[model samples]
Target: MQPDSSTGLNGKGQDLKIVSLISIGQHPASGRARRAEQDGRAVELGMTLAASSSTQNLTVLHAGDSQQAALRSYAGMGLESVRVLQLRESADAVKTLSEYLHKHAPDIILTGVRAESGESSGMMPYLLGESLGWPVVSRIADIVSIKEGVAEILQALPRGQRRALTVRLPFIASVDNAAPEPRQSAFGPANRAFMEQQQCHSEPDTARNGWSIVSARKRPKRLKIVKAKTAADRFKAATAKPQGAGGKIMKNQPAAEQAQAIFDLLLEEGVLR
Candidate 1:
């Protein structure tokens, strides 16, 4: 392993260049304050990976309103500076991000699996990867290693299982929440960090909003098994079907017979042993 002085790489072999895509999330509390979304944890994971001696550089990128507070929250997590692609709220985010990435390609682009707000299709990474013609990996727990233009990744799976995958360079990844929690934001670093904004002129995608959206008073009560403690329990809950429309109404029936019917239904639904 040799260090590349020009690239600021330490004595490890792979030339690790990383970019973390960040976004604003609704605050945990009801009112004013803002936060980096749950997916922002991916950026923190990227930062941790870059902190390793093997990595060359880690850059943070965001395409959103310039004055958003979430940007500062990210900086507080120890990013020296964040690169901004200034965009309007109505701008096509996918296009804007893809355009910026195309001009300046990195070895790896990291983002959260999905955003928490506003048409959060969670398709940005996939779309960006498609635009760049690079493979996109989702639910990534960790980067095991990067060597000789190939990256070994640990993919998170259900039931606490992890799968190993090796992919060629210049790819996008959506980090899983199963990864380690991000570091807390600090006031000092956040206040000192510099922001470099670049103007973007991508057109807004109006087609997505063409469909009518309506809110109803009550949503259907989904069938869910509460307090699942095992993989089987979770699986059962996820696959469980809800009861059909209505049940037989017992009128003028014996009390003992009605009790038996109710008990039978409970057993069939697994509500009672």
Candidate 2:
């Protein structure tokens, strides 16, 4: 999709483009209701960009039911209107999303790193990029500037590092958590927002059903020590892997010997030391 230069400028003298902010609500069962906040970090990121002076026009899009309560929650956040392409529960979401994007041909598309429900494959940006043949910028913290066809952006990296990059226009970007948090949705604006719905034919790809569902669980916390005092120390601390427990096993040993071996292994592993 090419960005039309004529339609690119806003009254504020900033270059403009049709920025599509794709949003998905977290499934009610996804443990988000307890927080009383919608589970769409990507939507917030897109909202932030849409509110900026850089974008002349912004359109919010969703593939599911337009009337979903969670969608209204997004409207309350700041969007004036949201367009929905009704999608069945089992429909091929990627295909449907691509079709709508093709028809609208937005110059810039923004999405979250991953969805809060379903497979949460975190591959939407990649898939959309592939389908639209557009360059994708991941973990974007900020868009510094967009002149002509190139955009300068700041990327968030591990260890609190930031990287600057430039990419051509008509691209997809995945927002990083490092970006500023979004403002809370106001009840008044949310009530005034309009929702536009469109019908689309999309069938489920049964092949996706073959995938296994795993129970969600909390990850064990890793023990970290601030052993670094200087730049070199910090580098070493960042690169070094924690040592694993050390032990020895005895196979087919006599009872007496096995007991002794077990005691020795405990000491070797520092369990008894």
Candidate 3:
């Protein structure tokens, strides 16, 4: 690979073994099998990291059915192959995945913040990090640069902000939705890339069997949202309810001026504080 100034490295970065974990995604509305959104972004992030460096060591991995069509959908995004560890449906994924990751010992591991199917507990990365004793960075937007033996990371924060961090080599990161969107999947590569499978030891989720799974309570209807471009428009709409006998109703005034009057009234009444 050629040297890139953006990576903050003197030359090409060392061959960084990158592994992106994928899972069978379920569409929320349709309840159909599909490629997961965040996992796809994880793969996209992995591709970006691999393309910037010297070696092509990016491996897309799954720990479930090899015959699932969703896996191919991921490969359609320019992967030559996807590695699958064959395990039964009843088996627990965390233990098997931890074992596989420990054996390979990749330099960087990428995964979605949470799975789209099943429990969706959003704890896979943390569990794996704890098991492997590797540093775990959660909800990261991007990896800004890598140099010598450290990586500069941009972690996503609340309210669309970002926090910069630097961590040493060999860490796991959970890609957030705030990261770059994934490339469109193509039919050719997806159809051509094969599922490389290997039989792995599996343990039944005996604990899960004992716990009863219940459907989550439906969310209450949300309040109607009124979008306004300006503060005056917002104030007019928000305070436009039917005027009660005790309420003051102004007339023959420009909307901007009326809004200003209301604002002043509210401010003086301690309602705008």
Candidate 4:
């Protein structure tokens, strides 16, 4: 039997394995547990990639407490089950997750740019990629196509731009909001979907020992530019001036002239060059 090179399937047509890493999210307003926004998108992307190959396998994996009710939200996204690597809150998930990936050797790993709770440093993909020695693509909009052993990806760029990148199989990518939206999870599946739990080696985070977290100091205000040519003008500019009809007003004039007057005033104020 020949493998599908276009879809990048193995000889058995079931070799491609995709995994979406999910984390418990906290609502900003209430600080309550909920399905993470980006993690949902990660699962969406993983499902999208799997849709290309008929026999491809997709798994939603979480490395946290399995008892959290938020895990069901991911299962609601038309998934039969969610695999949870049971770990404590203080346990560093990178080591355990990296070990799992090493053992399974999935073709692709999808994750969110940042978590909604805890430190949320947005460093999981980098750390996991470093540990696994795989290429990590950050803020990817979509995976265009997978051929042979390479997958073409559309990387999300600033200012609504996308850059095409081709990465080999067994790579990690951080899903961006620019990607397709995730489907709404149904209540039935969420309640029925089984939570497959597995005990994993928990590595305590020693770096956070005795860590002091304080509210960050506010940034200094931006310096203002004075448009006055003379020091006296600058002083007058800084000082409060008498209100009511101080500057020339263009009430009755052509639209172009009024626009030009406004433009000139803005230019004089150093607002435009």
Candidate 5:
């Protein structure tokens, strides 16, 4: 899909295209979750883009991988139709995906904060945007509005607060869980999508060079894995333990006395010089 040509003041012409990233296959843990949220956010943003367009014209493309499960999940989002681009699993996945995206040149591209596999790299959107000479907005929660070739975006920060940003057209934004929940697909549409397979054309491999893979008998664990049936159960497990609880509360003591008491306690605990 090509970018629409009806240039507004912000230079985004009519008939803008929105592209979403999809995982090729099953990832170990949070990988799927991250990708799912990203896809959902993409659809949510697309819906917003669709609403704001006077022509009501938009195209949704799915940069697909071999992961049938991930593809189906994305297909079921009940948004616009998906255009799938198949890339070799062993090839430089990022480069291949970027190349397809560049060919399409969608006005606004939406991706997940991170993928669920290899390096868990959250770098695709940024790297792709840099390669395409487009701006990138990470951790987007909402698309407030689009007009005159610019998009107003809402982003969730480390705290509970959200910040608003306005980016020019042809930009990339990585969606986070802060975006709307992904819609479920009706069985009919999903089945139809499977029947109507989208064809992908291979481009010259621009994959990077100089890479090494070292096999190891064991890899160090980055985080402890725990399985829980419910959100409450997960919360319970996380907050189950308390640390360093015992402390003297010297209330109603003189200022100097309190300082001495703290010093004595520190010395007793072998925490002082």
Candidate 6:
């Protein structure tokens, strides 16, 4: 007998549901732009998935601390009623997030490849999946289709190649830059979302972890503040700098001559000891 295709189990057809858990922003000190890009990708992929499977239930969730950066990033996404799950800064964030997902029981959970804070651990999805006994697909570029209880995922590999994968329901996927560009948020939807707040109830602290508020006598600003009116200006400034403009390329030279030329260039540029 042919194996079940719809359910990917017993051939029984079942409805699919998707829940995207997007992280808003990194800590004040983190230097990587991956988190912001990932958040945008999550929303873009979630919107695409929702549109493709209009019949399936879809919900977008934001899981992170209440930092100013995080809140602003998520609030500006123009998402419809994001579910905010807050946890203590010193608490086990992974455990807290996992517990929430267990209760929510979404068929598919989407998160970024990693967070840019304290741990900067790209292990959230894997750890969360392990804790919840669900499969995880990292660096997922797109969701090709969702049928019955299985989803067709497109994993982005190195060198711009893609791999097709099929995973059962109740899985986690970490989005990457290979996904489509995020849409420009509509001001009307963003303004309306404030009226419909969906805040998740904070779980009680069970783990015994000491908490101490360290008050500084003279609090020194620890964050770097760059004032830019627009994101395009910021992007242009970041990638505009060019290095090694006067370097020479010596082709058809002997190996010994090439080595000497490189050493001379390094000395001329003060890059060699």
Q: Tell me, by lDDT, which candidate is best.
A: 3
In the range 109-212, model 6's lDDT, one tens digit per residue, is 77777654445558878988889888889898888866665678899997789999988776889998898877766556655554223344454444534434
Error of 6 at 79 (Å): 2.0
How well does each candidate superpose onto the true structure, as a TM-score?
Answer: 0.72, 0.71, 0.77, 0.76, 0.63, 0.61
| Cα error of candidate 2 at position 200, Å | 0.7
Worst 10 residues of 6 by lDDT: 1-10
- The top-ranked prediction according to TM-score is 3
The Cα local distance difference test for each model comes to 0.77, 0.70, 0.87, 0.86, 0.65, 0.65
Q: Lowest summed-lDDT stretch of 10 residues in model 1? A: 1-10
Pairwise lDDT winner, candidates 1 and 4: 4
List of clashing residue pairs for candidate 2 = 8-16, 76-190
Which residue pairs show backbone clashes in model 5?
Answer: 6-13, 7-13, 24-67, 25-67, 31-116
Model 3: residues >4 Å from true position, as ranges? 1-11, 214-273
TM-score of 4: 0.76
lDDT (tens digit, per residue) of candidate 4 on 135-191? 999999998878787889999997789999998877899999998988998999999
lDDT of 1 at 130: 84
Model 1 bad stretches (over 4 Å): 1-11, 28-33, 53-56, 211-273
lDDT for each residue of candidate 1 in 1-273, tens digit (9 for 90 to 100): 121222222336555668898887765456344555555677777777687645437888888787887789889988788888998877788888887777776778999887765665688898988888899999899887766667788999977889999877778899887778888889999989999888989787798668554322344664544788999998887787664567799999999999999999999876799
Q: Write the per-residue lDDT of candidate 3 for residues 150-185, one digit (tens) a residue.
A: 889999997799999998778899999999999999
List pairs with backbone clashes in candidate 3: none
